[model samples]
Target: MSTLNLLRCAPHALKKQPVWVAPSRNIALSSFLRDAPAATASTKVLPGHEYYPGKEEYGTVIGNREIVGHGEIPYYSDSFMVPCPAIRFKEVDEELGKLREKEKGDWKLLTLEEKKTLYRASFNSTLEEVRAPSGDWKRCLGDNAILIGIMFFGLSVIGLSDPEFEPITVTNEWVDAQTEYLIKRRVQPVDGISSWYDYENNKFKPTWSIFTTKETSQSVKTLSERGV
Candidate 1:
């Protein structure tokens, strides 16, 4: 047999010898070597459409305006004028007139005895004799001296007898007169001008300004031009 025929037919030598083979590219080596999907048009960034920093980049943006911090901005209008009501001096005069008439009527209706009783009560006289004086002595001594004498008698008789006695009767008319007097004293007009005024023209402006000053300031003007 020839040499080539003899090598091909040699089974013992082929089984003992090592075989050398080239690696195939079609076989997968690892899981990382697998093909990835292609990116869509939406994932890609377009040219000249890059992000740019704005003026309010670091602050809060509201209606295209950036606010760094709260500033001193007044929410109210400076030129806004407040409404004031006019003073009605006529009404005050009428009320005062009515009070005066009532006081006169009450005074007229009050008897000499009632007046004397009120006088004694006002001075806080406690002596029963002075409170209800008898004989011509009360008529001659007058109310003032009688009240003084009663006070002196009360002080002298303190340890001898209890000075506590019945209180004098105060009428409803007296109480009403007293209350009206106090209210009138407080609410009476200062220089005859009862209402507030803003000197814009010849007309009188009515405001709720109750404060009155002897002299006018730059912001506040006097109610009366004639000093009432």
Candidate 2:
């Protein structure tokens, strides 16, 4: 199934697992954590004011923009320019240092199941459109909001204080690492869930890394190859 559906269903399947709320082992972050925004068919990106008129015929920026025409939508360019790696690395390093300090003493307090449930529920509620009413366990969580909330919760339980947006840097990297690690470790595991290690003060913090079953991964691969 799709990543969003898995997250929506996870809480019910794994109730009160401490790992869901607060994981104790290092896990990898999966695409499910990042797919919400992209998965919503209702979502759309309006063209930015910085349109490239010169490259209109180049099939680059054109794919990037979405224009409505003749009762249809057209995609322009796909190439998105990010900052230079050197600058990115420096910024990431600075952020990581602060996160290390902010997350100090936070480690493996909650079980992996609890962390997962909380993470999944919070993520759905915060990020995606909430199908269930407020206070429902199955609402979607926002990527940045939920990450910060969970990170803050984890850190606060251990007597640490977060400033703001600190978790994004840490969570994004952790998620990427987790996804890569899982894809490497398991041959086509499930698609939506993710795993990762929580760290603080240069030490690997105890946290549960969520993972998809190998069987599910194989099924996903089979379906994907068949374009199902």
Candidate 3:
């Protein structure tokens, strides 16, 4: 195979990318590499892809995988922590068939290309590829920003559409009247803003009379006699 074709095969680190999006899966590979008896329609791999490279052979079915109709091969997924996926990505072609035979021997005997081919047959991407930082956050932020701006624009449109809906109570005259009414009622005479008023003098009193200033404590005593 060309060098490019060899590189097309993947690695475990690149295995991390979630681009290999898949859900839970199921597949039944018959243990012996013989023809499946015509009696049964092999249950499909739940992940939605072919596990066996060719139609003639099957591998031993692993786990609680239920075998159903003939279709939909298993796939790889980062979200799922399954150590072994239900099926391989591709079938056993001539080159891969040879690698599988050699794989049964010592690890040191296999070339780097053969090792990579085995890994790719099983996994879609390296772990790092699955866990790689995709800039999805930028898209989310942009979408939310647009949504907020739309909401703000809607609020501004409503506000501008009806000038009469604006609150009248925020005017200076209204505030002054509200303050006068509160003072007239002697509201909160105990340790509150209203307590600072001198009703007899018709004015607000200095709180310096309560707290000992740099001047003296007599100011406190004088203020204490005011029934404040």
Candidate 4:
């Protein structure tokens, strides 16, 4: 017979039997303690003081002093205090002096290209090597293969179907284009601000000016004087 027919034949077997009840015992003290009302906020007792219910307007007292709500007492101690080192400032100054001397020595060793690279790195230059890729494609493939193998093994153990994994493919031309784009972005001058070279300061200061008619006329006059 089918599962449904078997269940219908034993319908009384599925019905719940009557539960047994124990005899009740007298618990006058327990009932009184359980049903007793808790102390309200106004009638609450503070440490070292007892609150008098119904006389809450006057408040509690202890040893001639009227006890108000718990008062905060500021505490201070030097139990775990640490003593300052005698040569703290002197040691710090000596270390800073040594660092400055070392920096001066290192600055002399760095080439112009290395200095420029350092400056570019301080900015948004993500590439460690501008001309070539930093990581090996073989290593990346190996890592991906291991990850996929683990995933497939886990799915198989759990009785799941294996998913198709596609490999990432890139052309030499695409990589070169990306490298060129990065180089261009790294060396590109700030927009809306030209003539940044400050002859007086011997440094470039990125600045911009509004092209008003008055300023334009003044610039033209200056350019005419310079014979530009």
Query: What lDDT is reached at residue 70 by model 4?
Result: 24
TM-score of 4: 0.16
Worst ten in a row by lDDT for model 2: 82-91
Residues forming the 10-long window of minimal summed lDDT in candidate 3:
61-70
Which has the higher lDDT value, candidate number 1 or candidate number 2? 2
The true-structure Cα RMSD of candidate 2 reads 35.1
A best-first ranking of the candidates according to their TM-score comes to 3, 4, 2, 1
Q: For each predicted model, how many residue pairs clash, with residues at least 3 apart or on different chains? A: 4, 62, 22, 0
lDDT of each: 0.33, 0.35, 0.52, 0.35
Pitting candidate 2 against candidate 3, the one with the higher lDDT is 3
Score candidate 2 by lDDT: 0.35
Off by over 4 Å in 4: 1-128, 136-139, 155-228
- Compose the digit string of candidate 3's lDDT tens values, residues 73-192: 444344335444544556656776677667667878978877877877756675557668879999999999999999999999998999678566855446555555665687778875
TM-score of each: 0.11, 0.14, 0.35, 0.16
Model 1 regions more than 4 Å off:
1-162, 166-177, 181-228
Clashing pairs in 1: 84-206, 85-206, 85-207, 86-206
Top candidate by TM-score: 3
Least lDDT summed over 10 consecutive residues: which range in candidate 4?
Answer: 82-91
